[model samples]
Each structure stands twice: as structure tokens, then as C-alpha cells.
Target: MKILLLLLTVSVVMAQAQAPHIDSSYSDGQIQAFLKDGFERNDRLLQAKAYYLLAAREQNGGINNEYTITYLQKSHELFAASRDAYHLHRAKLALALSYVDQKTFDQAFDLQREALTYFEQRNDLFMATHAAASLANTYKLMGNLPQERVYLERCETNNKLLKDNILSLAILNSKVVNFQRQRQYDQALSAAHQLLTIARASKKTNFEIAGLFFEGILHQFKGQYQTAIGKLFDCLSLISNPNLSPEAMQCYLHLSQCYEALHDYPHAYQYSQRYGQASHAILNNQRQTALQRQTLRFDAEGKRRQIANLEKEKREAEQTALWQRTITIGIGIAAFVLFCALFSVLYFHRQKTRSDQIIENQKEEIKQKEINELRQELTLQNVQAIVTGQETERERIAKDLHDSLGGMLSTVRLRFDALKTGQPTHAYEQALDMLDNTIREVRHIAHNLQPDALLQFGLTAAINDLVNRTHSPATPDINFQTYGQEFALTPTQSLTIFRIIQELLYNAIKHAKASEILVQLNWQTPSLMILVEDDGVGYDTTQIQTGMGTKNIQTRVAYLNAHLEVQSVPDEGTTVVVTVGV
Candidate 1:
């Protein structure tokens, strides 16, 4: 994580030095259609964001505003369904802002309230403050200052709670603009100063530019020409900071107004020309990109449809040719009359050979059937051995509980009965202690005999218990990783793998004396792969004869029609790989 941050910082600095701009091309209608299909085909999150942001840009451009709201709403629902609360709030806020633009104040207010609830519930004050400010702005637009003031105070309070002065500046700037609309110069000037102070500390040059703009407006209102001009141009210089295009253009237009106010006719004319040209070029580039994107999308869709129709036509032509060939095949059959007689005799002879082979296969199958039955018997016996051991253990615990604990507890209960209620002795307490321990031991034994947790949990928990019981506190590291998906094998498959793993582990613990062992099982498409590897003094492959254990391993694989590979050296290590068809 630390290394990634350092690398990201270096990349950002280098990219900034290059001043590379991302002029993205996108079709309005075609992008909408593609994104709609993207959700319909497989409603994934990145696709939802893809459509939502596309619609947002369209709304921002004042094109297809209604449809953009619909897309944004749909994207918000998708994000909510995916449980991405952050993005869900973002999309809802965008939709609300769009509604505000369309003068649907009631709907915008409701959406913003909902968005605020999401942010507030998660204690995300940054987003919460934004939502609050948006609500306040809606109230102001409706000419309700009392409600607007309440929401504005809330926004500021939340911003303070978050200690985000940048958000504070943004909110105050919004309020100053509202005050300016009411011709409240004193209030506007105060708010704008607060905004400027916070904005300078923000370190975001773009935002500081906004702060300076508001300050310049305040100064121009007061007829302070020189100071405002210097401050405005200082803000303008930051316009080429490699992250300022839209703001830069806006700043230039506002600066022309400032120049016009000072009655500098020539300077005003120059500033106005620059503003018009820059705005025109930006809009022109946006339109051309949109056109190119639309053309490419239409051409691609047309080509796809044409290819599909051609394929259908080709298939129909092939079918027609096939019917014609069928008619010609009748004539060819008659022409080969002499060859048919020789082919029949050869075919009959081959059929006889096949019949013999089938008989041989049936005999071999019966032999394999008997071997399978024998293998099943051996596997059952192994299971029975473990079960028998558990039964013996249970009997021993039951005896101790009944003979030792039960007798001692009975004696303790008699001692308690003999004691007066007001004159209980320390001996009575000792007897109580022994009685409690006895009861606990009995319960422990019962729990060990029948581990209810095994049924409640799963094979993993069961293995964990077995591992804790058999191994010491500190032993060789055990690595167990399940790949793909977890699954319960059929009884037969489970038994085979379990017994194989047990035998391998037993060898590692008792004979091989290995320090480390690794067992892995991976479930892949239509197959499963099991691998067991150990770093130990492995046996020589040539020296390994078909012992009882070796036969058991090979036979188990054979029964499952699985391929098993064993690789080992005299001293290095050993690895067992098994692949079974699902």
C-alpha cells in the first residue's frame, strides 16, 4: 500500500508536467442505448456508473435533461441494489440537482432529503453538508429565507464538525450569492470574506480562484478597482494549472465584466473577445466529439446487423445445396452396386469382431465390479475402526463419570443435607466445589463424545477440532486453501479424499517426520484438482514397491476414473496431484 502511494504520487506529478488532457468522445443517444443494454444484459456496477455519468454530462450541457434524469434515477437504483451507499447517494444528489434545474422544486427537495439521510446515517459529514447546502439553496430559490437560514446553519455546523474549511468556503459562497440576489451588500460582503479566508487555506487553486472571484465582485461593488484587478488576474493565472479549463473559461467571462465596470473600454473589449473565443472553441470541440462518437456507433451497429443477415443467407444457401446433393446421391448409389456387395461382407466380419470385443469387455467389467466391492468393504472397515475407537472412548468416560464422579457427588450431597442452613461449614463448600467439578467433567465428556458443533458448523470446523486435538501447541505450519468454490462431495468421493488425506498426514507425522505440510483442493469448471505437498526426506521413486498403502491410493484413483501423479526424490520433497472429472 505504501509503495503504491509513492508510485501514484510520482505518476501524478509526471502527468501534470505533461499537461495531458483527456478529451473524451461520446455519443449522446448511442451511449444511452448501449448503457441501457449493458444493464439489461448484466446489471453490474461499473456499467451503472458508466450510464449515470454519461447522462449527468448531458444534463450539465443542457441537452436531453429529462432523459438524463431518468438514467440517473435508474443508475441510483442499481447502485442501491448493489449496496454501494456512497455511489447511491452521489447519483441521487445528481438527480436532485437536475430536478432543481427543471424547476421541480418539490421533487428536488425530496431527493436531496433522501440523499442527506444516506450521508447522515453513515456519519459522512462532507456529503451531508453538501446535501444540506443544496436544500438551503432550494429554499432560497423559493423565497423562504427562514427555512433557508435554518438549513444553511445546519450545513455550516456539519462542515465544522467535519473540520473541512473547503466545504465551509463553498457553502458560504453559495449564501453570499443568495444575499447578492436580494441586494444585501453588507451580508454578502461578510459571507464572501469568510469564504475567501477559508478558500486561501484550502490549497485547491481552482477553489481559491472562485474565492478570489467573489472577493473581486465584492470589491467592484465597493468601487475598489486596482485591488480587485490584481486579485482577479492572480486567480486567472492559476487557470492554466493543468486542472482548470471550465473554471478558467468562467473566470475570463467574469473578468470582462470587472473590466467593463472600471470603464476600461479597450481592456474590456480584449477580455470579452478572449472569453467568447475560448467558450466557442470548447463548445465546438464537444459537439465534434459527440458527432464522431455517434457516427462510429451507428456504423458499428449497421455492420453487425449486415454480418448477421449475411450469415443467415449463407446458411439458407447451404441448406438448398444440401437438398440438391441428396437427389444426386441416389444416382451415385445405383452406380456403386457392385462395390456394395464387397462392403457388406467386410462390414459383417467387422461386426463379428466387435461382438467378440464386447464379450471380452463384459468379463473385464465384472472383474472390475468385484474389485470395487472389495474396495468398498475395505473403506467401510476403516470408517468402522474410527467409529469403534470413538465408542470405546465414550464408554471409558461414562465409567469415570458414573463410578468416580457420581459416587463422590452423592457423598457431597449427603454432607450438604446434614448441614444446618445457618451453620454451613467450609467442608460443605469443599463438597460443593467437588460436586460442581464432577458435573462439569461429566458434561465435558458428553460434549467430547458427541460434538454438536460439528453438525452446527461444517467440515472445516470439524477438521479444526481434530487438528487441535492431535497436534501440539507449536507444530509445523499447516496450509489449507480452498479454491474456486466450496462444496460437499458425494459420500464416496468424500470418503476417498478423506482417507487418502488421513493416510498421507499419518505418514508425515509418524514416518516422514516432515516439519511442513500443504494440502490444497481446487474446484474448477467440470473438474476438481487436489494436491498434497510436503517438504521432507522423500523416498526414492525406484525403491517404492506396491505396498498396501500404495495400492490403496492407486485403487482409490482408479475407482473414481481419476488421474493421480506422484513425484518425489530421495531427500528433497514429495508432491501428490489428483485430477477428477466433475
Candidate 2:
């Protein structure tokens, strides 16, 4: 009987091991069947192996975090209970990964450290190095740069000790990320080049793609946009699963940024849209996984309850049979009790089904809401871009009017004065009068479009002129104040800021009907702050619509890459503040 039990256990273990195929193409149904079979066998090693396989498969399939963590936890417990050191460490490592996926960095780090310690104690250099690498990754995620570097160094040391180039390649990959995070571009580039060379030497497609992606990122950081684009495209071309792979998503994002940097706005927008879609898809997948996890947990609990009740019924029936062996009525009573138990089970099962259906409906509603929100956000961004473009064109037209039309008119006036003698014809005098009026109008229009003071004399003079011009007997008592030293700014920055101030003043006068307005400009060496305040009937900010003037102000603020704050309340004065890097 002992030999037979040993043989049966071995068979079960082997069967469990063979159940979940390692092939990437294996179906989820097959994996579920294997897990069910192994679990039903109730052998420790077999169950542990089955759990590990399920975790691995779920991870590869991008299934929800709960299931992965559940399987890993189960596997860890079984492996530890069975005293299987090798498999226990594997289970711990897998558990650490699940923790990482769930962003539980502290837990991940602890588990990885335990695995590392175990491997080192066993002199398992290969797994020890891998564990060290994982620890490094967890540290990176935790934003502990120094600690990350420390573990990475340890990983390199072990890899070198093992004389394993492939293991060392992983170290190099981590170095690229580490150096990139530190903004050590030269070091990052060198590491990426080395990684590419090694990956090519290994002739591994995935590693090669990863190397290219890293190189692309390094080039992008170095401002070699075109070269970065080339490398990223090469990486993309080799990517088999763009939606599922983090690297591919990163590639899409980097490509978008690279195109934007190159001034290829159309392509940039296209890639950016793709990046957004891919990100949304990933998030949706995570949400679905979370929901699935909840469903699974519910189902498991329901099964446990069913099993417990059934066991109780069986015990009761056995007791009844013992008491009623001589009485046939006792058999009837047991049968009736069993029927009642079955009915209760069925009723509870129906309730569980209804609950599941409700949860699924809620999940669907949340998913739809998220999708709609994402769509609306994308639409807003697109509209904002168009508005920005329109503002840019207005600035350009204003500059053209000031430089070309205004200059031409001034030239003509100069010629007319030169040609004038002691007496002038009535038509020539009328023409001169018309010309004067036209010149004034042209100047006014040009100033409205793009302020000359902003372009020529910088922000301080421009703002002072704006306040002075806007202040009159009929208008608000506008006060202009300046603090700190005035500094030079790029034309684009100056115009954007000027436009923002103009919009704020215009809004205050037209909408707020203010009695007094204060405009303040403060220039600290590397930054500028603009404050505009008005004592007027302020409207509710939440009720403010995205009108052209408001949109223009927003566009200009964005163009300057500045922070804008608008505070207003009914019956309270409005205040607008802007801050920008100088």
C-alpha cells in the first residue's frame, strides 16, 4: 500500500506538471482544466506546481492582479509546507512579481530579499543573480535610486561570478534604465550600445528589440530626434504584441515625442493618439482583470459554503442512519432532510448567480463611463490645439501688419511730406488727412494683434503700456506695479504673456464692470509672475464657459508653459495670476 501510494503520488505530480502547457499559445480553458484536476488530486507538490503554472499563464495572458497574487500565494504556501527549497524560492519570486504588479513595492522588495537570501545560502548563483535583479527593479520602482544601484551592482557581481554573459546582459539592461533615470546620457548610451551588441550576438529577437528601444530612448534624451525616430521604428517593426508589451507602449510614446520634437505635428499627433489608445487598452485590461478576480473569489467562497453545508448534511444523514437502522420512518426523515439541504443549495446558487450578474452589469457601466471620459478628454485636447493654432495665426498676422503695412504707410507719409511745398492742393491735403487716420487705425490694430512694446521693450514696458492705455475716466482705475529686476524674454514668450494679460483686462472690463484693477509683474531671476486683480461683480468660476477669449487666454498660457490661476465668486472680486519660467 505504501509503494502504491508513492507510485500514485508520483503519477499525480507528473500529471499536474504536464497539465498546463508552457507554450504561449495554450488556451485559458486548458489551463483552467489542468488547475481543476490538480486541485482535486489534493497532493501538495502537484497543487503547488499547478498554482505556479496558473500564475505564470495568467501573467503571460495579462490577467488580473488578484488571480495572479492568489495563485502565487497558494503556491508559496504549498511549496514551503512541502519543504521544496527550489520550488519555494521560485514561488516566492513569482509572488514578489505579483506584488510588483500590484505596486506593493515594500512587499515585493521583502519577498525578493528572502528569495535572494535563500538562493545565496544554497549557492544557487543563477537564481541569486536573478533575485538581486528583481530586488533592483523593486528598488527602482520605489524610487530608491541608491538602493537600486546597490542591488544592481550586486547582481553584476554575481553574474560575473557565475561567468554567465546572458545573466550579465540583464545587468546591462538595468544599467541603461538606472543611468537614464540619473540623466547620465553618455553612460546610458554606452550601456545601450553594449546591450544591442550582446543582444545581436545572442540572436534573440526580443532582446534585440529591447536593445533598440533603449538606444532610441537614449538618442531621444540626447536630442537626436531623427535618429531616435529611426531606432524606435525599428523596434516597433519587430514588436509582435504592441498592446500587451510595456516596451511597445513606451516605444509608441517615445515615437510620438520624437516626432513632436522634429516638428512633424501630424505624425506626432497620430502616434500620440495611438499611445493614448494603447494606454487606455492596458488600463481596461487591468480593470477587467480586477473584476474577474472578484468574480473568482466570490465563486470560490460560494463553493466552500456549499461544500461545508453538504458535509454537514452528510454527517447528519449518517447520524440518522445509525439511529434509525431499525425504523423505516427514520430513513424517510433523512431523505427529507437531504432534499431540504439540496433545495437550500440550489436557492443559494441562484442568489449567487444573480449577484454575479449584478456585479457584471456594474462593471460594464463603469467601463463604459471610463471610455466616454477618455473620449471627451481627447476631444478637448484636440479642440485646444486648434484654438492654439488660431491664436498663433493672429499673432503672425499682427506682426505682419506692424512690420509690413505699418512700415509702408510710414514710408508713404515721409514721401508726402518731402513733396509738400509752401502750398498744397485740396485733394493732397485730404489725402494726407486720410493717410494720418489710416496710420493711426493701422497702429491700433497692430497693437491689438501683437503689442510692439512686448516685442521690443520686453514684458514690463508692455504691461505698463497696457495698464496705462486701459486706465481712463470711463474705464477702471488700473494700477500697474513692478517688482524685481526686469529681464529679457523670447519673443514668443513675451507675446503669449502679453496676450494673456490683454485677455484678463478685457474680460475684467467687459464682463466684470470693475471699478478698479491692479496689474502686478514680478521678475525673479529665473521666473516671472503676473497678477491681475479687479474690484468688480465677479461671476462664478465654475459656471464660466470656454469662450473664445477664455480659450485664447488658456492657449497663450499653455504656449508659455505657465501656471494660471483664476479665482472669482459672485459678488466677490476676480483675480488672475500667472507664473512662468523666465
- The alpha-carbon RMSD values of the candidates against the true structure, listed in the order shown, are 21.1, 31.9
lDDT of 1: 0.67
**Top TM-score hit:** 2
Give per-residue CA lDDT, model 1, range 466-539, as digits (tens): 44544664555566666787466564565555556555665666655578878777878778887877888888
On the 0 to 100 scale, the lDDT of residue 539 in model 2 is 83
TM-score of each model, in listed order: 0.37, 0.41
Q: After superposition, how far is residue 138 of candidate 2 from its true place, in Å?
A: 1.6
Model 2 alpha-carbon drift over 4 Å, by segment: 1-43, 54-60, 64-71, 161-166, 233-256, 259-582
Tens digits of per-residue lDDT for model 2, 1-582 = 111111111122223335442323334445454555554554567667766776775665556468679878988998888898888887888788788878988788788888899989999876777687777777787788778889878877776667765665667777888889999999888988888898789876766887899889889989999999999999998988888777778888999999899899999999899888889888898899779877766665564355345446656766877677747777788998999988998899999999999999999999999999998787767755765676688778878887899899999999998887765688789989999989988888777876767767788888888887777688988888999998888775676788788889988888888888898998998999999999899888888788989987886777566899999887889999999986
> What lDDT does each candidate get?
0.67, 0.77
